[model samples]
Target: MSYTPPSWSPPGQRPPGPGPRSRRDRGLTALAVGLTLLVVAVTGAGWYGYGPGAGDERTRAADAKESAAPESTAPPSTGAASPRPSLRTPRPVRAPSAQELAAARRPGEAAAWIAADPTDLPRRNIRVDGPWTVGGTVVQALYREVTAYRLSDGAEVWNLTLPTPVCEAPEHAAPDGRIVLALASSGSRRGARCDRFQMVDLRTGKAGWTKELLRDPARDTPAIIVHTAISGDTLAVAEGLGAAAFRVSDGSRLFTVPTENPGRCHPDRVAGGSRLLVSATCALGDDPRTRYSQLRALDPRTGAVRWRHRTPAGRRVERVISVDPVVYTSIDNERLTDDWRIVALGPRGELRRTIDPRPKGFEHCVNVGIGAGLQPCPGVVVGHGLVHVGGTDRAGAYDLATGKLLWGVRAHDGRTLTPVGFRSSRGTVVYESATPSRPGRTFVLGEGGAGKEETLMNHPAAAAEAEYSTMAGRVLQAGGRIVVMPSFVTGEDDRRQPRLVSFAPAPE
Candidate 1:
């Protein structure tokens, strides 16, 4: 006899609207009902009281069914847990010996070696400054620690943990490689922010000293660390409220100069070249329209002012780019006109010459963000015994001695080229191109009036999609290397992973 499962009808309903059911059918239906009632009673008893194996068989059957189902076609989740960071102490970095240093300093050898063997150091926070070279080592600021690595081999040299997270990137190392300065701030509650000035030795990676610079609980504004420069034994720091000079040997205050108006007169630059030039803006009165610029050359040894130069009324000095016997200043008044003037100052803070370097039919210049703030772009860069002026529509190079235009290039097809830096030793000028059709291109203008363009993507050490800005002090050239720190992007997922890439200069 064939065993068949049965279906039951309600008491008042007909039996499936058919003839009378058979005896086998009636027996199967009663068995099914009895089994269902038994299951319900067992499940209810297990849920209410306790049963060791109650529902285990049913759960196993359900799990087996789920396991045999087809796989999903959607992509894997990116939210998977990341590997934990190592908590063990970092291995000690091997220092270069005297013989290694001598071999690494040979002409053209260091760059070629570094190019062939590129070093990549993973960073945690991308808001801080990129890597900087001091002597033969590259110093980088990691999460809460600053690490030094050998430039040639990428070996860890030494590391120092900061008391708090770094607020700003480390400033450029002095020409002689004495000290590195940076600003660090502790996490604040309410409005109280604690800021400190930290200095470290370039050779040994040892911290020299740290000083408390600003602590204000009432004001919610962040600490503005404007400029940091080291010359001889003196270190100068310029902030929003004022500028101060400190002795590097010990964290002692040398001299302080408070701005005339903190809101109006902001510190521009602290050039520690031949002289310490602390330039700031001084508003004539409450109105921002009547603001004029002031330059005070201070003695590096003492905080005494060497000389003071004030611009005429209605003019403001936007930037002080370079100070090598000649002080190059960028002056403009956007309220009155759209043109900008490149004013050259002598060592004595006397106005030398003002050259208007605007294109004929250009409309207005745009502000490009650099570092922690925004500054007007298409400005001037002074180097290689020449003054390179950039504008919205065109760029030109002028002789530094005579102020005569040497060569000019105009934008074509909505593409703009701006001078990024000048290789004075090689007698070649480097410009970055902004073209929508292709990736960024680097154009090198030679002394013979020839321009060669190369796509940055093709460059071995360049970033994936590299770009440059006309911000005065963004590019750093040291130790036969060009270090570019681009403006940081915003948004949670859109931010670029901050990286400092070193490239060998283009062949002359």
Candidate 2:
């Protein structure tokens, strides 16, 4: 028996009376409506799934996990972090007053003096130790001794003599101003070995410790002390055959690194920075036609070899200059070839790049000069993110990082420019005229070669004829203040003496 199905109705409307409509047809219509509703709901969900905020919650969860992780333990690179704070005393900030200037300029008077035998006066650069505050007095090194003097009157507060004559300038005082290391010998000639290494108290001028390194008594040649450096409580001394490290506090030996073959590889020079120690070894044998040079970096704390770089046979590393994570070295062939190259190396002894500093169109520009002799050829100064090469007729600056030439400038008024020093900020370079007769024209050129030429001294005599010595060793700066040693004290005169003169910048 077929039973009549209940009829469906719209909301608020009466149901249609059952007639010819079949129940199967009504059931199929209801099923289709239900499926359409399901499809609409899914489409709505799909649109919301791809919206902008859909993945935000998941991203935040990942970020939270990263934030809760542990910190890294490795030391930061020089580019990644600021340098460790220096322990050395901050430079003295007191600018000389008008009255102090007048007193300093007197012919016979000076800010201070060592008053030792004339033979004992530091013929080389005098090592200035401290304006350290000790018992309310500022104390500094005075060549053969440590002396405390009044800045106002140049009067002596206390004085202490070194154990032996200084072979070279004393190693720079320790960063913390606790101790100072000096290499001492019985005589001054190159053959005179610096057998005694002495540490002096920076504050009290008291002797801390003295250690005499063992030496080969049978050796006849002069003892070659290649380099001496002080950094972070360690003292490193490099010589002809080997390099050694010692604790600066008690003079205890740390470690020594010797050359593999003294006949082939002779260690010539060494340099140190805040973190790394570098040494250069040159090859010397019967074959003068070709030579080899090697450079090695050692752990400053332990004398472990970190890395070694060797030049191609027939070339040698002439000099090494370390400026922390970066090292600048000069390379040349055995015959002293005309073309010389300067190589820059990274902290790991990786080669960064090489630079040629010779002037344009000059074939024999290899006479670069440094130190007291003042030979021909230009000088090279590296600092302030720039490499400055000074030639007799021209000078130029190169980008320190990339070795790209930045600017080249011709000498003004037919005077050759020589770099004396760079300003602490590295934005300005100080140049002295090569013409000794051109006085009153110390040029201060800006880094980018765009600033006005600023004169350091405005005298009328030629540089050589000037009453005072204007050489690099004579012209000194401490915290922006300039000091000029007397010509007599600088040995410009026949008799070398001790005197200090401070100068203020001439008016514009």
Instruction: Name the candidate that leads on lDDT.
Output: 1
For candidate 2, write residues 99-212 as lDDT tens digits.
534443333222222222233553433333333444433455544566654433445667788755454332345665555444545534333455667777666667777776
Q: Alpha carbon lDDT of residue 88, candidate 1?
A: 27
Looking at model 2, which ten-residue stretch has the lowest summed lDDT?
45-54
Any idea what lDDT model 1 has? Answer: 0.45
Cα lDDT tens digits, model 1, 1-508, are 0111112112233222123443433543454345334432432111111111112222222223323434334332232112111112222112223244334332322221121112232222223344567778777664356766665544568877777555453244555555644544543212322256677776777887776654334543444334566656777776543677777778678877656544656554566645567777566343444667777777788878777788776666555556565544443332322334567777677887776543222222222211121122333567776776644334556666666666655543333345666655324444443221222234455443324322232222122122221111234444555444432211123222223334443344
Task: Give RMSD to native, each candidate.
Answer: 26.7, 33.6
TM-score of each prediction = 0.60, 0.59
Worst 10 contiguous positions by lDDT, candidate 1: 45-54
lDDT of 1 at 64: 38
Provide the overall lDDT of each model, using Cα atoms, as 2-decimal numbers.
Answer: 0.45, 0.44
True-structure RMSD for candidate 2: 33.6
Residue pairs in candidate 2 whose N, alpha carbon or C atoms collide under 3 angstroms? 87-175, 88-175, 191-222, 436-462, 436-463, 437-462, 438-462, 440-458, 440-459
